[model samples]
Target: MSSTGIEIERAAGFVKNETPQIVTSRFDVEDSHTLVGYLATGGYEGIRKALTQTPAEVHGEIRDATVLGRGGAGFPAGVKWGFMPPDVFPRYLVVNGDESEPGTYKDRLLMELDPHQLIEGCLIASYAVGLSQCFLYVRGEMALAQERIATALNEAYAAGYVGRNILGTDFSLDIILHWGAGAYVVGEETALIESLEGNRGMPRLKPPYFPAAIGLYGKPTIVNNVETLANLPWIANNGAEEYRKIGTETSPGTRMVAVSGHVKRPGVYEIINGTTTFRQLLFDEEYCGGMLEGRTLKAFVPGGGSAPWFLPDQLDLPFEASEVGPAGSMLGSGAIMVMDDTTDIPKAAHSLTRFYAHESCGKCVPCREGGTWLERILGRIIDGHGTTRDLAMLLEVGETICPGDFPHASSERLGLDAQRFPYQMTTICFVGPSAFAPIHSALTLFPEEFAERVRDVTDEELAASAVGAVPVELKGVAAQ
Candidate 1:
């Protein structure tokens, strides 16, 4: 494993050791984005090695490595690549670069610092999946990243590594870099595919219509994250066993973590999965070098904005999906958003809820209406007009939208049958859950902050409002 090589200064006037360098080893290297620079540092060796092996062999190695998608879902990438139907013609690969998830910027780092590495990874992925062309969908706002990738693509094509018999082999592939309209929902694989097809970005229904079987003009396709694809070259160059030995047995290899908010050193840091703790990420001299301004750590978003928040009590937990998931959150996108004690949880929840509300595509009623209501309620709470009943309503709306087992809302408490409540399978996509995770987490973890904003109301008045009872002044006025 390569070391970070640089020293990080902490807020406490101390220098922290550099972190591990796997995905980000080339980040600080001069001219790292260029083909020549990448070639000098053992670049394109993965494809050169991969070209000698068959597609099945490539897929087998990836499966053996257990490379999960780095794009928030943590789905197994090798298995996803194998989902493509056999003997299919004109299969395509789409690289999701819509890094719009709040607090997540790891993908953008790879694209900006190592475009050639991404291209080689894409080529290796295409070769493994028997693809002829790959589409790189970058966020429209990322001009520099797009420019870097475009230049690299042009260079690859000129070198005969992109089109028409790549590297003197019968295999041929083309890469197209497309920009998005800056929609967060487009980060979804199906929504991204829809946008790539010139349609409004909206997620497609699953089952018989999954992307692997039907994607990109209705042909077999495989969609992968930029970081996920970048790892292919590493696994291709070094065997899976060596790669698997670095991190935890289940989630192997190093992952790029984008640490932001209240950190002494807020930037991208690469760490072996399941090997580092959130506490070390926040306080250890080698990582973030402790919190900013000597502020005590209150809570943190373990994954991206969509993932649930974690209290300081969970600080010792490893930064891995398996551990975080069992602890009531996930390692979504590996985005660590640290919040200091002085931060206002309710107000922060309101801001994030409003973002999701504004970004809702309105294709699904649950997400559209639910996100709007969540933001509005949180806004009212933040504005100092919330009621105790509003807290119950917040949990209810989140449950109705996402259909999860909300621990606060027991079936017996509502006097309703468990089977009758829509608490297990709710929305059309994961957006509903994403929109509510932070809200539910805020309400669950920081009840005192929310309670401080709650307005006092009589039981009679609250019950009257619950049943939509009209005010005495407005009741007769409406009729008149």
Candidate 2:
């Protein structure tokens, strides 16, 4: 394995000890965005080589590689590709570029740092999935990245990597960038396809409705995350065995982790999957530097924002979706959000609940109404104005959003706690179980703080709102 030659910093980057040069192939390129610069590196070789082979051959290569979707679900990428039917109408390899999930800046990093590599990955995927066209549905706020990718597409066409008869071969592929209006739901494959097709972004029902069976324009389509596809060329060129050498048996290859929270250094690092534990990432970052002095660790938001929080006791857990799930959380999108000692859990839950409420598109009544109620109740509780009954009410709201085992009424759970009186039931989203984690924990762990809030003490007596400097997004990645 190529030892990632750069000097390791205390924190930053997606996954630590990332694949030496797999995704980041041109850190030193002069004007890395320019065509000339890309050509200087081994840019279009994968596409060039792929064009000479049959579509099935390329598909076979990807299927053999066993790359799972990096956007959180960890679905098998090859299986998703194999699902695409043989239709010439307009099969699309939709690139899910909506980076709205709180801890997922890795796609932005890849797009900004090496646009060409991503394009090549797009081309290969398009070819592998028998797509004559591909779409990169990027988050609307990323205007600069849109322009960079547009420029790269133009250059790729000029050099015959895109457009008709690419690279002196019989195959042709074209990639276009589709800008999103910006919604977190758009990260879901069907929702993304809907937004790309100019509709409000909301997840479509499944079954007679798989994206590969009937997708955008009512044709078979396959949507893959930007990072998942970006790793394509490397796998195609280097072979599956080469990619498999680094990570565990099931989760082969490196995973890009967007590490934020209390640590010495906070940034994105690419690590071999299952190679690092939660403990190392949290306590070791020099930038964020563990939790602030007196503060102890609180829950962590693993995966994307929707994933359950992991308490400090779960620190030894492996960092993979399958592994994290059994522990009652998900390793969603590789975003490891660390909460420090002084953080108020209830307030934090309220903050994220508010984000979901604002972004819930309203296409569906449950998510729309449920999210709003969740934020209101949780926010009230965090502000120290809630009764203990309000805690049960919060759980009711959490149930509204995340109805268990998938019942229709559950999904549409916008029921209220008690329209009649005190002895009634309640309604809600994950914010309930969410509110309890911090609220209950505070009641026990920091009883005095909860007591002050409950007794209507002065603001100074309220748990000081876990103050710390939040990292800023500079260009592509999050910075401390």
Every candidate's lDDT: 0.81, 0.68
The C-alpha stretches of model 1 lying farther than 4 A from their native spots are 1-20, 407-425, 459-480
Give lDDT tens digits, candidate 2, residues 403-475: 4421110001223111110111122222223322323333323334444444333343233323433322232
Query: For candidate 1, what's the RMSD?
Result: 5.8
Candidate 1 residue lDDT tens string, 89-174: 88999999999888898888899889999998899889888887899999999999999999999988998878889899998887
Q: What is the lDDT of residue 469 in candidate 1?
A: 90
TM-score of each: 0.90, 0.81
Where is model 2 more than 4 Å wrong at Cα? 1-19, 28-30, 285-289, 292-295, 404-480
Per-model tally of clashing residue pairs: 0, 32
